[model samples]
Target chain A: MRHLVITIGCEYGAKGNAIGRKIAEDLNIKFYNRDLVDEIIEEVGIPKEIMEKVEEGGTIAGKGAEGDVRGSFSKYADLTDRAIHVQKQIIRKLAEKESCVIIGRSADYILKDTKDIDLLRAFIYAPDEVRIHNIMESHNLSEKDAKILLLEKDKRYHKRHLALTGSNRGDRHNRDILMNSSYLGIEGTAEYLEELIRRKFGSEEE
Target chain B: MRHLVITIGCEYGAKGNAIGRKIAEDLNIKFYNRDLVDEIIEEVGIPKEIMEKVEEGGTIAGKGAEGDVRGSFSKYADLTDRAIHVQKQIIRKLAEKESCVIIGRSADYILKDTKDIDLLRAFIYAPDEVRIHNIMESHNLSEKDAKILLLEKDKRYHKRHLALTGSNRGDRHNRDILMNSSYLGIEGTAEYLEELIRRKFGSEEE
Candidate 1:
């Protein structure tokens, strides 16, 4: 009774979102990523303004810029916390229902304890230089600016992982597979992961 | 009874050799890389010339350039095969005797089945751009030339891995830790591996 469920955690610029998207399409399953934010909004009634802000380098934990749209940092923190809690519930419910690929939001840690489904937890990472180059090309930023934003985003991702799982993201023991996406490129990595999943869980349609 | 034995396999220009050197210095353990060639020569009675040629991409498997130095392709292949077989034995004996770090020559695959030591199998890699940048800077080669060499080296390495292990090196399941050395720089990767070794085998003296 091993249903296929994949959770992917990735460093910024690792093309994890692209890989997850491809895997979801290949598997013919639902893909959850930033769309989970909307689901959280629907499930928990978190305001869209705060969710958007939180999505854009705005941390719920009293640690972002000082452009308060709604209220104090603590208020947003509470809302963000509540939103994440609801997001976890929605992720679990989705996994229980059918096969799907979930990216980020500490979904690997969230689903680690589930027993009913076969879980493939993967962590994708790339070199800083490659990621910085990617950000510069994609975001129309200078080298210095891209480096700064990439590092900040990495810090925020790490903080979020710790906040969610009480453990660092680079801990290899926690992952079923750890890959360097820069070596394989986005599409190559997607193909690699697809083959890996098929090998581990068998090539059965969901 | 856990002796720290690390096998570091890396892509060209990933600075894996530098990291292995620093780890050897830091841990005060024997570091084996090309030195394995010497060991193989001594243990297997292979000629120094053939071993050196094989080490320098002159695979006796008829895959390399046509430069007949000593004998026919089949004879050199037989010697190279014997050298690798003897090298594997030497690697295991070294691990059984003392803590050490070995780089490349598929040490990860060789010592994987060892029963007495704590093995930390790591694969260090970097994006083509970053590795090409590194090669250009270090080897004083043009970017075009550096890229050519890097790809050729990667192809040779992949071929050797397939020859030795009968499996593709990029398979993530083969490694315990996969890191992008370009992200951490050479010294930083060294420090990272140092910390990882300490965590796995404790910080006590060997």
Candidate 2:
């Protein structure tokens, strides 16, 4: 009686990607995080440089360097838009076919219109100072550089999300919950969310 | 190793008050909601009509009544401002002495600077339609009236919060989590929150 699907939109150093994967493992569901970028790259033939920029959590606001995308502003925007649409199709199919946890890529917003599937959308964020320290440790960057990187990633995330979904991630109108990763850490958060999701969509006989 | 203190900020009709009280019960901690207002009224000698107005979640932007507090706008504003000061004192005292769950009145922000205690702040909100329907059913009002009431309460909550704390409740830099009550209902939400609170503040040996 459970068709549980969860989408996690997260800040850069919040470790939402790790939390989502842990939840999927605990629930024995399919986990789709980086595999998404791979699928879009394979299916849509998104340029490698563009995908690499995306991996760096950057917006396509600047110039692109080579042959495929032509480096024009409008064309770069167009390619990113096209990639978002393809990502949407891939997300919808995954939700419709099986239970999975999707990390970012606006999957929560993408699957919001469905009624038959049990979907739980959560955004994981920690304090800026905590996230900054995390990025410093993980990326071997200075405090100044980590702060700059965090802002850049956040801006790019919002820009891409707004273009595709007409809203940002924290637009909680359709989202189910928001969690701060600091209090529970990745494992504890996954444990709590797993229980919460089960309670939300579990069989009535319980 | 637990010095438990929780503060709940909520949108109208989200049942955050109920959730807070239930968490207190489950945790066997002190519950502070209306009592905070009553204490402010007693300690500050705040006028009855204004407290009633405050009870209705209305800002002190307008006039007051006769006798104890002059019916002038300035006097009315002065009284409520003084009451908020008393309320802050009461909140700090409670957090210092005992474990408790406080509802609204910006207790979360009031206690944000402390380090001697364990604290978890949560805001509860529901979908507009669900909350509006709840308002209509509970207050016996038309949908239009219910929507108006909801907006008024939210505005006053923010206005009072800003005037007191220089920030609003949904401000997440200091708050811990936000939960939507529609999917879990009050009891279910309370149950999860009880477990979450214990996990957040319990002994390290666990």
Candidate 3:
């Protein structure tokens, strides 16, 4: 079998991207995040508006803004459904090609049935205060704006996950590892997770 | 409120002692393990033969054994009630003194009724191969003897835990952290558990 497939799911600005990037770099494997969004749009010819809505946690109506487009727009405009399908495709393709680190999009459930995929699924999160501070520092947003944005992003992600998989995004039942970035910090959490993976699947240095 | 009373339960040679020791050391708290056995012997003055049998997984009869006996006595005896009571007394005394780490002896169910006790329970375990190797190295025993010793020890511990609590020993349902020491070596497991305890207690270190 090939190397393990590590999937990280997290709220935005929870340092999921940084952790994924670090794991990919350390293991010398490919990393996918927003880059998969482009591939998805290219393959399905999804419009920019729908892509933005889906990425930001909104649904795209197929037609007439009501219920006319469920089966018409090639893959439909239900953003959550479309996102799930696109992510599944990407994960399948990645599995066929090589093992790598994938961030978000319910990859844990997506690749649940695949073989030789030692899926190390992790849920990354920080407290509200830590998340708000992170948003303010990274996006140069006001305190009120950061809090509002964080709350909305959290809601959307939760909604999208529920709509896609009938479960809460941060539920421990769905994850192999539930880590608080606020406690371990980004580097420490990543190193700890790396050690676990290495121990499960032999050290890379070995 | 007092500091948390942490209990770690695991099969023999599962690194529970090492993890408990590290957590106690790092938090600058007292830890009770085999020392608990000593305390029980001193307080109850149970005979050495009975103590050996009880420690090795035999139980006293419900009818004949006296609550107190001293020195060497080879006669068969029942000290189950006394043993249970003494163990509970030690746990209560420890709780009264300070927050500390207690290894085994059904501390979870013992301290289950106490308020303001942040009980961080953990189950530490490893693969059979890893555990067997550990036993050999630690006890300087041959492979065959080590395997037999490990099997008997595991059975004894399991039965003792079940006898006391009416539940399986080291079950994750009763634990806050279900850790595999096989993945994280002794030091790494301790570090991870310390991080978990800090999070559970809402320590300011974060």
Pick by TM-score: which candidate is best? 2
Any runs in candidate 2 off by more than 4 Å, and if so which?
A48-81, A203-206, B34-42, B48-83, B203-206
Model 1, A50-73: lDDT tens digits are 555555433545463356654576
Candidate 2, A1-206: lDDT as tens digits: 43767889888899999999998887778898966646655666766665555443333555454334554766776666666566677788778877889888788888888887788999898999989989999999999999999998888777766766777556666578888898898899988898887787773321
Give the per-residue lDDT digits (tens) of candidate 1, residues B1-206: 76888888888887788888899898899888856636654756766665555554435555523766545666767777776677677777777878888888788888867888878888887767788998999899999999999988888888767767777765554566576665457786777667656655678896
Candidate of highest lDDT: 2
What's the lDDT for all of these models? 0.74, 0.78, 0.70
Candidate 3 overall lDDT versus native: 0.70
Task: List candidate 3 stretches off by more than 4 Å.
Answer: A37-41, A51-83, B1-99, B102-206
The residue pairs found clashing in candidate 3 are B60-B78, B61-B78
What is candidate 3's lDDT per residue for A1-206, written digit by digit as tens? 56678888887777888988888888888788866745665577656565556654434442425666546654554445665566568677775567788888777777767776666777677667778888999999999999999988888888767656677676544565556576567776777678768756777532
Better of 1 and 3 by TM-score: 3
TM-score, one value per model: 0.50, 0.82, 0.54
Sort the candidates on DockQ, descending order. 2, 3, 1
Q: Ranking under TM-score, best-scoring first? A: 2, 3, 1
Which candidate has the top score in DockQ? 2
Runs in model 1 lying further than 4 Å from the true structure: A1-206, B35-44, B52-77
Error of 3 at B161 (Å): 24
- Model 2 interface CAPRI class: medium
lDDT of 3 by residue, B1-206 (tens): 56777888877887889889998898888889966655666666766555445654434442224543432122443364565666677777776677789888777667766776666766677767778899999999999999999999888888777766777675444554456676568887888777666655767421
